[model samples]
Target: MLQHIKMYGAIVLAMIFWAFSFIWTKIAIESFQPVTLVTLRLVIAVLLLYAYAKATKKFQYIKRADLKWFVLLAFFEPYMYYMGETYSLTMLNPTLVAVIVATIPLFAPLFAFLFLKEKISPVNILGIVVSLLGVMMVIYEPQVGVETGFWGIILVFVAVFSAVFYAITLRKISSHYKTVNIILYQSIIGLFFFVPTFFITDYATITDIKITYKSLEALLMLAIFASVLAFVLFAGVVRKIGIAKTNVFVNLIPVFTAVFSWLLLGQQLGFNQWIGIVVVVSGLFVSQLSRKRKISEKIEEITQVTEY
Candidate 1:
């Protein structure tokens, strides 16, 4: 029970940090170009995580055999994922991007099954559908109806697949590396991708850059809370719970983002949005049904064996 509490707490907290990242990124992009912003975010996260791991004497060296796996993990995530999502924001409205991003877990079960041989339960499928419905309720307003282009939809879908593949690749190195080190190395290696792309894409725009204290604070918050700590906690949860079950918790991101927007940004929520939040929570509860019952059955078997 204690272990379950910790695992759930970690994932939920990770979601909260990520929810806040939306706000932070909004503030940050005011001063920095998207590619430039992501590169700097990676730079700061690498430095902070590397320093912490070194100070704690918990840094683990990567084996040569595992090097390719780490590279692939970084490619899937901070590289492809961020590149896709960030650029998509330029073409599409944030609401469309988010609703699309919220589909990550819907595709996760197939990847988890293919890569990790994890079984997907009917309840898990049902839960994902229900949660997706709730997400639409929260994010999709019939009145506003934001326009989207083909390229924008394509780019965000790139992000969705990148995230799915990232989770699959994470299982490759997560067991061998400490959570912090996994986040650290990924951030370090991610810079290789982000730096060149930054130069190629956003370099010309640099002359217009005027740094603001507010944007700096937002960037720093993104680095520390969103990139470093959130990745550590999320990686730890993935290692503990496996990808299919772990990704189910991702459905909470949009719901939490809405609530955070309401509270922090003074964005008033309507009745439908509040109802959507409740429905999203209910779906999360449904997804865990399989895990709980499977554990109970195992305990019964153990008891029976002891009686014999």
Candidate 2:
């Protein structure tokens, strides 16, 4: 029971860090270009993860055959995912971006069904529709003359799909490597991708950059808490429990993001947005019903077999 509590605690902590990540990115990008910010963030994360791996002697070398998989993982995540997310935040509010990102788990099972031949239940389909409705509510403000942040919404969805793709690739390689090693490789390979883009896009204007305390603090929080600590905790939770169960905790991200954005950035959610958050979270819970039922049935089967 204690172990279960600790595991859940870690998962919640990860969610909190991830929720705050949107706000941090918003703050950091005030001074740094999107690609530049991501490059620096990855560099800091790589250094921290490397030190941790070396100190604990937890580093595991990847097989030559599996090098491509790690490269693909980095491409989907730190490359495409961060690009979509950071650039989108430049146009949208942190709370709105967080709400969009919260849909990753809602779509993961569908991607799994399509790519991995995983079974999808009717409830999962229904959850997708409901969650999408919730997303529309949050993104569309009726009182506003126009659909606010239209392009930003699209960019964030790109990030969402990128994350779903990343999750799929992660499952394929997770068994072969430790979590720290996987993230370490991702950060290193991701740097190679980010550095070139940063130089091409922002390097010429680098001299105009004025560093600020908030930006520095935000970058550090993102590298340490959001990137390293959150991934470590999440990977530990997934290993301790399972992906399906661990993913259910992702629903808490928007809630945490909403609160933190309000407290830190003074970003307030309207009534419709609040209602949308609830509906989205409800959909996430509904989607997991089928998976939970399967787990329970498996447990019952084992119990009966033992009794026999």
Candidate 3:
């Protein structure tokens, strides 16, 4: 019981860090270009992860055959995911971005069903439909007479799909590698993708760069808490409680983000947006019902099979 509590605590803590990451990314982008911020963030994460791996002697080399999988993971995640997310934040509010990202787990199971032949229940399908409606509500502002930041919403969805693909790729290599090693390699390979993009896109603006305390603080927090610590705690929780149960904690991210953005950034939601957030969160909860039911059924089957 105590062990379970601790694991739950860790998961919540990770969620808090991840929730705040949207705000941090928004702050960092004020001073750095999106690609530059992502590259520097990855560099910090890589150095921190490398030091931890070395100090603990937890390093493992990827088999030459499996190197491609890690490379692909890096491409989808720290590279593409960060690109989509950070760039979108430049155009969207932190709360809106966080709400969009909160839907990641809602879509992950669908991708799993598609790629891994996992069974998805009817409830999952309904949840997707409902959540998408909620997204539309959030993005559409009848008062403004336009969809709020349509391009930004589209880019945030790009991040969402990038993350879903990242999760899919992660399952392939997770069994073969430790979590730290996976993060370390991803961060390193992600740098390869980011460096060229940074130079091509933002190199000219580098000379005018003036770093402020707020931006630097945000960058370091993103590196330490969001990149390194959150992943470690989440991976650990997934190991202890299984992904379905572990993922329930993810629902709290947008809630936390909403509160943090309000408190820190003074961002406020309109009445319709609040309704949208509630609906989106409801859809997320609804989506998990099928997964929980499936897990229960699987356990029952295993029990009966064992008895026989």
Candidate 4:
């Protein structure tokens, strides 16, 4: 129980860091182009992850056969995921964007069922339904007056799908490489993918950049907390609790994002958004209960065998 609490606490901290990501992106994008910002962030991420991998001797696990999976993961995650998210944030409000991205777990089961042929339990389906309603409530502004609302939503959905693929694909990846190796190689490859984009998108300005206090602070927080710590915590949770249980925590991200936006960015969440957060959190909780029940049943069966 204490360990579980610690896991959730880590997730809460991660969500707080992530909540600031919208504001950070908005600020960073003011001076840097989308691809350029992603490039620079990934470069920094690669350096940090590389250092971590070396410090822990994780690089030794990177066999030649694992290179393909690492490259593919980079394609799905930081490369495609961050790019789409960056593009979408430019078109929508940060709060709205966070709300939209919160539907990642809604699509996770669909991806699992489609690609892995994993059966979705009724509770999982219900969780998806409730979370979908929550997402709708959160993002259903009276007037989506932005010219690019449709495209922004589509891009956000793309980010969600890419994340789902990344999560489900991790099993295949782990068969080939260790987690730190995967993180390192993926960031390295992702950085290289953004290399040419930097040139095409005027990446030269990144060096000439004046690091204002606010921008530098935001960047440091993003690099340290959002990128490194969040990923490490996420990986640890996956190892501790399995993917399905760990993923339930993701639904809580929107709740934190909304709260943080209100506190940090002075954004207001109407009653409807609050209701949405409640519904989503409730659904995720139900999913956890259902999983627990299954585990308990298995334990009972083992006990019965031992008694007999």
Off by over 4 Å in 2: 1-8, 117-119, 142-148, 239-245, 292-308
Per-candidate TM vs. native? Answer: 0.76, 0.87, 0.88, 0.82
Query: Deviation in angstroms for 269 in model 2?
Result: 1.5
Q: Tens digit of lDDT per residue, candidate 4, span 165-279? A: 6665555555556666666677778887788777876666767776577766766666777777777776666666665555555656666767777777677778997897787
In TM-score terms, which candidate is top?
3
Candidate 1, residues 195-216: lDDT per residue as tens digits? Answer: 8888898998899999999989
Clashes of 1: 0
Off by over 4 Å in 4: 1-11, 204-211, 234-249, 292-308
Candidate ranking under TM-score, highest first, comes to 3, 2, 4, 1
lDDT string, candidate 2, 71-158, tens digits = 9988987798888899999988887788777767667667767776767678878888898888888887654435447778888988
Candidate 2 lDDT: 0.78
- Model 1 / residue 169 / CA error / Å: 1.9
**Model 4, CA-based lDDT:** 0.67
- Looking at model 2, residue 33 earns an lDDT score of 90
Q: Model 4, residue 89: displacement in angstroms?
A: 1.2
Q: Between which residue pairs do clashes occur in model 1?
A: none
